[model samples]
Every structure is written in structure tokens, then in C-alpha cells.
Target: MAEIAFPKDAMRVLKETSRTFYIPITFLQKELKYSVASAYLIFRAIDEIEDHADLDNVVKYEILQQVSELFERPFNNEEYFRILEPVKSIMPDVTIRLEEWLQACPMDVRPIVADAAREMAWGMAKWSKANWNIRTREDLDDYTYYVAGLVGVMLSDLWAHYADEKTDRDLAIGYGRGLQAVNILRNEEEDLGERGVSFVPDGWTRAELFEYAEENLAKADEYMKSLHKKSILLFCRLPLALAHKTLNAMKEGREKMTRAEVEQTVEEIQSE
Candidate 1:
């Protein structure tokens, strides 16, 4: 085992950028908390570039490629920040000091985080160069896998690192896919209207997309059922519970969960 310290900057960025994720991550203990948070910040950096409405496609590809290249060697604080400085302000605060996050992660966990970041960055670069023309479900799956499915794999790796039980990687991937699908549906208008990107396949009805999302969420439910630790289970369950609720709400034309609904869901999950 290696020494781990929580980076205040990473915590701040995590809280600032994501509320739902911030809650479940708080349930993670010690090094696992730091590892997962650091990993998340790295992914968020890549996502910020991918989703930047103002950046040119060529610029986005170059920045993402630079990100992928940075993880290939030792973490260089100056060069990393310099290369990404153009979009640093728009990205989460944690991304501003990536090297610090790397320093805080345990040695064993650092490689997993770096590898996943490399894969995500590279994939994002590829898609950005293509302008995200997701013409089919396969294209959508490939894109989501780059941005979200890999998150499931990364969390599964973290779960394995903290506990003795092995995680089913496919189920975990499904968990990511499910959540991303819900996001695509929820943000359909914004992604298309603002970003000119449409995640839904042509000829797909809203009901069909909702069914596709639910099927994957069912896999996510199975992933949760396989976990034994209460904390880990809660960490995996809360977002998933919310995601399912979000999908149901979307069917009714709602975009988000109210605080009361979140609290009630927490109670239901805790009671089960």
C-alpha cells in the first residue's frame, strides 16, 4: 500500500462540478475516496474539452490528443497545465492541477487512473475529429464507451482495489452505458440544439430509446446486487437509483430530481 492524501483542490472541483457524484463518492473510505475522485477529475477534464461549445473541432482534437500524450510519461505539472491552459478556466478546478491529483493517488491506483484517462482522451480525440456524427446505435455505444462506459470499468477497478471480491466488468460497463443513455435522453434538446450533436440514432422513437436505457439499467441493478459492502453498495446504488428515477421522470418530461425526491430515494435505498 502507498500513502494517500486527499487533495483539497480535487474535492473542491468535484463538489463544484457534480452534486450527484459528490454524494456517493463521500461514502468511499480513505484512499479509495481520493483515488476515485482523482480519476473523476481527470475524466471531467477530457469531457470539458469534448463538450466545449466554443472550441473548434480541430482544437478539441489537438487538446485531447495532448492529454493522452501527457499520461504517457511522468506527470509534469508545468507542461500539463500549459498545454491545457487555454481551456483551464472552463474546466473543473481539479483539472488545473492534474499533477497534484496524481501525487495524491496511491501508486497502485495511479496507473489505473492514468490508463483510463489515456483511453478516454484518445477516444475523445478520435470522435471530436469526426465531429461526433453518431449515425447508428453502434456509433453511439462506441462514443458512450469512450466517455461513460469506461467510467464503469474504472469504478469496478477501484472496487476491486478496495475489496477482495471481483467485479463483473461487463455489468459495470452496462452501468455506465445506462447512465450515459439517460443523460443523452435528458440532454437531448441541449446537445442537439446547442452543440449540434445528437446521441439518439435516426429512426429511433423516444419510447425505444427509453427501453434501451432501461435494459442497461437493469444490468446496473445486477451490478449493485453483486456488491456486499454496505458503503460500496451505497456508492454504486445511489447514482443508479437516481438514474432510474431520472429516466422515469424523463418519460414524463422532467429534467432533474428535486431535493425531496433525492432524499426519499436515499431513504428507500437505505431501507431495502
Candidate 2:
């Protein structure tokens, strides 16, 4: 693979958006790193619109649908800018500069990333239309699949492209669900207090949700154990390790792992 410069601005936005992903991405080989970073930022851009505090559900649905339509066609800078113009002023920088992130991907894999993002945007639109109602276990599964599980499927494709590596697609979805479930747990307070949304099922408690996360994480472990590439393994393991530790911390009544604990976990992963 030829060398490609990962954009500095993309890296800066990535670090601002997600510390967990930013750390693992830095460990990937150059081309793979660029591809993964681009994909992540693409998803994060639409995700901000989906989770925006001020946007009405109807407005979110409209914007996300337009985004999905934009991804369906060939890349056009003018079209994207026009499509997003109505709410650009209110949107975050990550969401506003989505075109930059799209162009940053390795050309060969850009379509793959775009297609995955299109599906995710459409899914977000669906959930927003429904007001993000999670009434049952199946609803939770479907919601997570759209938002996060598709991410696993997309990454699996990227791995195959870059490393000639094949992963069990089912386990990959579990990997994403596990991580997303942990996020739901960690943000339960904010999700309810700020957004008035609850990802937990109709009658499920924290313990039930904990069990859900652990089950999917077991699949994530299987997915990681099957990897032969050291870089890929490290990339996958770093987040999984943190997810587990975060769950443990939550169990002990802590909202999340402290900065010191996060650094300690990274060091431990590096040592392993």
C-alpha cells in the first residue's frame, strides 16, 4: 500500500469526538489508519445529527434522510453543502465538515465506507422517526445493529481489504453491540436526563443491561481471538479491554473509568 497522509484536522476532530477510538486508530498501520479514521469520522458526523440536543425528532429525521440520500449518489461537494445548508449554522464542526472526512478515505475503500454510512444514516432516520423507542429486547438489538453493529460489518470489510483477514460477521456485529451497550450504560443518566431517551428495554434494569453487554462482549472476544494480524488485534483489543473495565467500574457504582485508569488500561494492553 502506498503512503497517505492522515489529515491533521481530521485527527484533531477525531480526538475531540472520541478518545476511545482515537487511541486505537493511532496504532493501526498508515493506510489502514487513514481508512479507519475516515470511516470513523464519517459515522461520527451523522451521529452528531442523530444525537443533537436541540434538534426536534422531525428535523433529525429529515436531516439524516437527506444525508443518507447524499451518500447514495456519487460524491459532490456542492450537493453536500447545499443539502446541509439549512442547519449548518447549528451543527457541530464534525458534522459540518463531513465532506472533508469523506474525501480523506483511501479511494479504493471510500465507497465501502460510504455505503455503510448510508445505511447507518437511514437507520438513524428510522429510529428518530419512531422517537428512539426501545420497547423490547428485539428493539434494542435492531437499534444497536443500525448504529453500531453495521460498524462492525464495515470494519470487517476494511480488514479484508487491508490485511486479507476474514472475520465471522456475526461475531463482528456482537463486537459492535457490546461496545454500544456499554456506551448506553455509561450515558444512561444523560440519555434520560438530557435527551429523555432510554435505551434500556421496557422492564430491564442495569443488571439486565449488564448481562446484555457481557454476552455480546464474549462474542467480541471470540472475534478478537480469531485475528492473526498484530495491529488489528491491538486495535480491536484496546477498546474491548476498556469496555470491560468500564463495565466493572460501573458495577462498583462509578459512572466511568477515570483518566488515570484509562491510561493504566492502555499501558496494560501495550504490555500484553
Candidate 3:
């Protein structure tokens, strides 16, 4: 695989915003790494807009709608930047340079990236407009599928394109749900106290949510095992291993892993 020069600025922002993802992204090879990293930054930008706690719900909805609509028009640098300007100050630097991110996207994966971003943006708009009232297991599934499951589908497409691996769409969706459910569980306190959003269903206990996460992750495990490429397998395993470990820690009332523990996990996966 030939190395692509991933944007230094975007890499800075990526490392700045997420230490966890930074590790796995390194495991991806060549253009696949470039494509996945750009997609992640684009998606992260949408997430920043959708989850701006201080922004009015109406503003969030409008911004999300506009972002979703961006893919419909011919790609315009200035126009895209302007559309994102409302939340730019609060967004990460990677997000601020969305047009550059788009430009960096591998030509073949551009449509997949755009489509996933638009779908996620629209879903976020719909849920934001509804004020994130997750009331049932199905509602929770719907929400996770929108924000994260769609990501699974998109990644499967990218993996198929780059790695020539036939990925299972259902298992892909399950992988996303498993990771996202872990996120909701870990961030519940902050989401509820600071954002006034509760992702947990009514009458659901921690154990119930943990079970949901575990079951999805079990499918994620299968999804990983099906892949033969070492780079793709390693790239996918880091996150899944972390999510599984994190879920276990959350069950024990710990929300994060120590740096040493993270290194140990990565080493174990790499050795495997």
C-alpha cells in the first residue's frame, strides 16, 4: 500500500480531540487510513454541531439540516465553510476545515463519506428536533442506529472498497451500536447533568444497558474475526477491545482505562 500524505492539521486536530481513536487510526494503511480519518473528522464536525449544549434546539436543527443538504450541491469551499461557521468556534480544528477534509477524501470513497454524513446529519436533526427523548428499547436502538449504526454501514463499504473484504451489513450495524451504547453508558452523567439529554430508557438499569452493549459487541467480535487482512483486523480490533474493556470497567463504576492498561490492551491485540 502506497502512503498518502494525510493532512498534518487534520491529524493534529484528530489527536487533540480523541486520544482513543488516534491509536486505531494508525493501524489503517495508506488510502484507507486517509479516507477513514477524513470521514471521522467530517462526522465529528456534524456531531459537534448536533451536540452543542449552548446552542438553541432550533439552531441545532437548522444547522444539521443545512449540513445534510451540503452534499446535494456541487462542492463549494467557501459555501461549505460558511454553512459550518455558526458552530466553527466551538468545533474542533479538524471540523473547521471540512472543505479540506472533503478534498482529502479518496475520490472513490467520497460519495460513501458524503452519504453517511448526510444521513447522520438528518438523523441528528430529527432527534434534536424531538429533544432526544429516548423512551423505550426500540427508541434507543433507533437513535443509536442513526448516529452510529449508519457509520457501521459506511465503514463496511469503505472496507469492502479498500480491503476487498465482504463485510456483513447487519454485523456492521451491531458493531456501531455496541460502541455507541458504550459511549452513552460512559457519558450518561454528563449528558444528563450538562446537556439535559438522557439516552437510557425509562426503568432500564445499568445492567440492562450493559447487556445491550455486550450483545452488540459480541457481534462486533464476530465481525472482526471474519476479516483476514492484518491491518484491517488490527485497526478494527483496537476499538472493539477498548469498548469491551470500557464496558466492563463501567460495570464496575470506572469509566476510563489507564494509559498503561490501554497500552497493554493494544500490545495484546497486536501480538494476537
Candidate 4:
């Protein structure tokens, strides 16, 4: 068996791609397994195609085209293998399983999934020309939904296939939305400091945006409470619980949360 060592290269891609998601993803592995991890890894590549500058355009498109081919007709090769090598090594069954997933994807889903992927690719496609306009929350919202919200949709399907559909999938979907919002919000300070850009531009001040972000988070909490109170997959609860802790920190008037506080909150989540 391949040792379950960290996929350092893949983890680097994950962290640069989705800073907040990296850790919560560790918890999700217990609930969603390595296939979900590989799927998310693919999205992270898609995300990097949009966000990271060190990468070249030709490289990104090449990667995307290969990804398209992989799902369009699953095959393993050096390029895909080198990139996803760690994942493949860790979960030797991942390739066959991923092909099975695509085969099972509805033929009609090509549009919906393709639309989502394209919307995501467009955002990245134009990353070099990222607009500073704040009026594009709709644009960002659409992007987030396409990339992450759809993950919720797929995850719901994944869960339902393995177990009963939670009457709470709607709530899970809300939690996903809230998570996406918080991510956009959390990156504001960095994006501004780094690039003079803001995702929600003018309608809200940073504090107001933080408040707006938390409103979605609060909805996520409501969805968590709505889950069967006695459910045992409590690890799935980590994301919501962390959202609550992060929101609490925001409410406490800190300009930004201290790393120690955030770490404490994560510890509280695992311990609780």
C-alpha cells in the first residue's frame, strides 16, 4: 500500500487555491473519502488557472483541456499523472472510480456542468484583466456557485447514493453558500493589499461585508441545527462549527482574527 503521506505538491496547490478549504477538507476526507478529495483537487487546478500568476495561460488551458478529456473519456497519462500523481498513488483506485463517476453523470448534465466549468474558466480566463469594479458581486456570486455550490450539489448526490438524502440537504447547500461567501470576504484584505481589488466593491464597507458574510454563515448554522440532532457523522459538522467560531471572532471587533484565536476555534470544533 502507498503510505498515506501528505501529497505535498497537491497540498501546495490546494492551499494556494483555497486557503480556508484546505483544513476543513481534511475533516471532509473522513466523511467524503479520497474520491471527493481528487474531485476537489481538479477544481483547485481550475481555480489556479484563474488565480495564480506564476502559471502561464497555455499551461492552464492545456491542463483544462486534459481535464476535459479525462472526464469526457477517462484516460491516464504522464501530464495528468504527474499533476495528480500524489492522489493516484495514495488512492490507487481513484482513476477507475473517477471514470465511473463521469460515466454515471447524466448525459443532459453536460450543459449544466459545462456551464459551471466555463463560468469558472471565464473568471480565470480574465484573471489577468481582473476588474476592480465592485458592482460585480453578481459575477462573483455566479462564479462561487458554479465552482463550490455545485460541489454541494454533487456531494448531496454522493451522500444520497451512500445513505438517505438528509431532509437537511437544503441546509447543507446554504452552509456551502455561506462558506463560499466567507472565503470571498476573508480574501478581501489580502486582495486589496496585494492587488487593490475587492470582490463586493462599493455597496458595503469591510465591516459591512463581514456582516454580510456572516449572515450567510448564520444561515449555515441554522442548517446545521436542522440536521438530525443525533446524527453521528459529527465530523461533517466541522465546517459549520468553524463558521460559527470565525463569525464570533468577527463579531468581537477585531480588525482581523488572531491566528491563535482561529486555531483555538478549530481545536474547539474537533474537541466538541
Candidate 5:
């Protein structure tokens, strides 16, 4: 058997198209890296399927079914295992996580992504599901939490494996949920732009955003305070910070978010 490359392309694929996770996961001990990376790659692929319009629903369904099949078998062909092939060249620790992502499958989630892919799928689905049921804003809120809040739940599970006696297992879910909540509020502008939907910023005012931020941040801080590990904090830092920053950006952008300002903000983040 060959070794795995771990942090190389396989992880690079995991890192692509995001400023949030790449640098942060590196803060962990060597043993924890690939499991986190593997989970990310699977989730990211699912995201692509949902986000990419070029791919048709039938193709997406096939990809989803392939994910189901991959989990049922520990062994896969090079194409299905493309993400792992590079890692197998230089990294040995990857074998375990690679197996985990391949073995366990969840159904209540019916989440088209992998069974193990996390709540983000549910949340995104709910966001779209809102189109048919647009009677109340609370319904919209429920959708965001499903897709994003579940991220908190899965992160807790992943973190629990690496934490020692000092870890506060009790608080992992709260922290994850906090992170998701902040994201939902931050994306209010983007959500409205893309879906013509508004779970928040019904009127788009700085005062409302500030109050919402204060409320959500209070909850996030509670979870952060509950955390006993520095690694988790480091992982939590950039996103929650960026989420907070995005809100401030929206306020600075005011009601009319110009194309230039959003592009500049994204560029600044990528360079950072």
C-alpha cells in the first residue's frame, strides 16, 4: 500500500473556494488534521453540487447516490476516491478518517450530500424550500438554522474525538450553533440578493443589524466561553470575526450594496 499526501491537493481541494476553514484547521495537532480535512472535502463537494448550476439535477442525484455507495464500501476506484489518492501517497493518518467518511451513513438527514456531510445540506435545502412556503419569516429562520446550525452539531462530534479530559464536550454543539447563527444573520444581504428572500433586514437598517448582532454574538460568546480548548477557539475566531465583519460591511455599504465594495471585501479576505 502507498502513503497519503494529506495536506497536499486532497486537502487543497478541501481548502479551495473559502477563506474560513483552511488556515484554522492547521492549528490542530498532526493527528487531527486529515479527519477534519476529509469531513471538509466531502461537505465542500456537496456544496458544489448545490451551488453549481452547470450540473443538472439528474447528475446531482447520481453524485449523491455515489456518495451513498462510497460509504457502503471501504474500497473505491480511483475516480470515486480521487480526493484520497493524493493523500494516500504521503500521509498514513488519513487511512482512518478516509475510512470513517466511507463507512458511516445517516438517513433521517436524506441530505443529498453524504450521510456524514452535516447539517449544511439541510439548511440550504430549507432555504430553497422556503420558496414554496413563504408565509412567515420564522419559516425562513428555521431553514437557515437547519443547514447551518447542524454544522455546530457535527463540529462538536469531530472535536470530541480529539479532546482530552479538559475539553468541555458539553459546549461543543452550542459553539457550532453560534457560528451557524452568526452566518445566517451575516448572509442576510446575500440571501436577499440571490433568493429575493429576507429572513432578516426586512427593512435593511444598521440599527436592526446591530441589535441582531448583539443578540447572536451574546449567544456565540456564551458558547465560546464554555469552550476549554484553544484549537476550537482558533477555528471559531476567523469565521465569527468575518461574520461580524460582514455585517459591519453591509452597514457600511448601506442599503445599496455596490458591486465594487463587495468584490473589494472578498479580495481583501482572500489576500489575508
Candidate 6:
């Protein structure tokens, strides 16, 4: 695969959007790094639309479905611009520059990224249409599968493409779900106050949600244990460790880990 010259601003936008992911992504080797970064930015773009505070659910559904359809065919810059024109003022720069992120992927694995993105967009559309109702554990499972599990599946595919590393798909799904569950926990206040949506199922307490997250995180640990490559292990280790620590912090009545603690975790991982 040819080397990709990622836009100068890509890393900046990534850092602004997610410091946790940005750190691990930076540790990845060249082509794999680019591919993973491109995939993340692409997914994050559509995710912004799904979670937009001001947009009505109807509009969110329309835009997300349009984006999903757009990825179903060969990408046409003009088509994407036209599809998003009406919402341009409210859209974030990341969503507006979707094409750039798509093009940033290495050609060999671009299709895989696009396919995963398309599925995610469609899934987001489905939930948007439903106003993100989560009334049961099964509903939560389906929602997380779309928004997070597919991410695991996509990463597994990318790992295979980049390093010929084969992972258990089920475990990979657990890995993604584990991280996302932690996010739902950490952002529960904001999600409810700002968006008026709750990922927590009906009649479930915070403790139950923690149990749900822990179960999936256990699978994540197994997923990491199955990896033999040092780089892949390192890349996977940071987020999992942070997720574990973040959960611990939350259990202790803290919102999240402090900057010093985050840096300490990274240092320990690097030293290992």
C-alpha cells in the first residue's frame, strides 16, 4: 500500500475530539496508523450528527440516512456536499469534511472502513427515528452493537489487513461495547441533561450498568490476551487500562480520572 499523506489538521481534529483515542492512534505504525485514524474520524463525523443537541430527531434521521446512502455508492464529492448543504451551518467541521477523512484511508482497506461507516450511519438513523429509546437490556444491546460493536468488528478487519492478525470477532465486539458502556456511564449526566436521552435501560440502576460494563470489559481483556503482536498489544492496552481505571474512579464517586492519573496510566503502559 502507498503511504498516505494525512491532512495536517487530521491529528489536531482527532485530539480535539478524543484525547483517549488520539494517544493510542499515535502509537500505531505508519500505514496502520493512518488507516485507524481515518476510520475513527469518519465514524466520529457521523456520530456528531446522531448526538447533535439542537437538531430535531426527524432531521437527524434524514441526514444520517442520506449519509448512509451516500456511502452505499462510489463517493461523489458533489453529492455529499449537496446532501449536507441544508444542515451546513449547524454541522461540525469533521462531518463537513467527511470526504477528506474517507480519502485519507489506504486504498486497500478503504472499502472496509466505508462499509462499517455506512452501517453505523444507518444504525444511528434507526435509533434517531426512535428518539433513542432504551427500554430493555436487549434494546441497549442492539443500540450499542450498531454504535460500538461494529467498531470492534471493523478494527478486527483492519488488524487482519494490516498485520494479518486474526482475532475472535465476538471478543472484538465485547471490546468495543466495553469502552462504549464506560462512555455512557461517564457521560450519563450530560447525555440526559443535554440530549434528554438515556442509554440506561428502564428500571436499571447505576450498579447494574456497571455490571454490564464489567462483563463486556472482561471479554475485552481476553481480546487483548489473544493478541501476540507487540504494537497491537500496546495500541489496545492503553484504552482498556484507562477504561478500567475510569470505571474505578467512577465507582469511587469521581467523574473521571485526573490528568495526572491519565498520564500515569500512559507512562506505565509505555514502560511495560
The TM-score values for the models, in the order shown, are 0.93, 0.97, 0.94, 0.63, 0.61, 0.97
lDDT of 4 at 176: 70
Error of 6 at 255 (Å): 1.1
**C-alpha lDDT of all candidate models, in order:** 0.83, 0.92, 0.85, 0.52, 0.50, 0.91
Backbone collision count in every prediction? 0, 0, 0, 2, 12, 0
lDDT of 3 by residue, 71-134 (tens): 7765676876787677667765666777777777888788999999889989999899989999
Positional deviation of 187 in candidate 2, in angstroms? 0.9
Distance (Å) between predicted and true CA of 101, model 2? 0.7
lDDT of candidate 2 over 1-272, digit per residue (tens) = 22354578899999999888998998899888998998999999999999888888998899899889989888777887787787788889998888889888988998999999999999999999999999999999999999999999999999999999999999999999999999999999999999899999999988999999999999999998778898888899999999999999999999999999999999988878
TM-score for candidate 1 = 0.93
- Candidate 4: worst 10 consecutive residues by lDDT? 95-104
> What is candidate 1's lDDT per residue for 1-272, written digit by digit as tens?
23535657678888887777887888888778888877887777677788878889998999889989988888787888788888777765556666776777778789899989999999999999998988788888898889888989988888887886577888988999999999888888898889888778888887878887998899898888778877788788888999999987877877877889999998887676
Model 6: per-residue Cα lDDT over 121-232, one tens digit each: 9999999999989999999989999999999999899889888898999999999999999999999999899888899999999999999999999999999977877778
Model 3 spans with C-alpha error above 4 angstroms? 1-5, 85-90
For candidate 3, give the lDDT of residue 108. Answer: 79
| Segments of candidate 6 deviating more than 4 angstroms | 1-4
User: For model 2, what is the error of residue 169's alpha carbon versus the real structure, in angstroms, after optimal superposition?
Assistant: 0.7
lDDT of 2 at 182: 97
- Candidates 4 and 5 compared by TM-score, better number: 4
Candidate 5 TM-score, C-alpha based = 0.61
Q: Tens digits of per-residue lDDT for model 4 on 117-219?
A: 4444454444334343446556655555654666665555555544454636555556676777766666767877765666774566667666656766766
Model 2, position 168: C-alpha lDDT score: 98
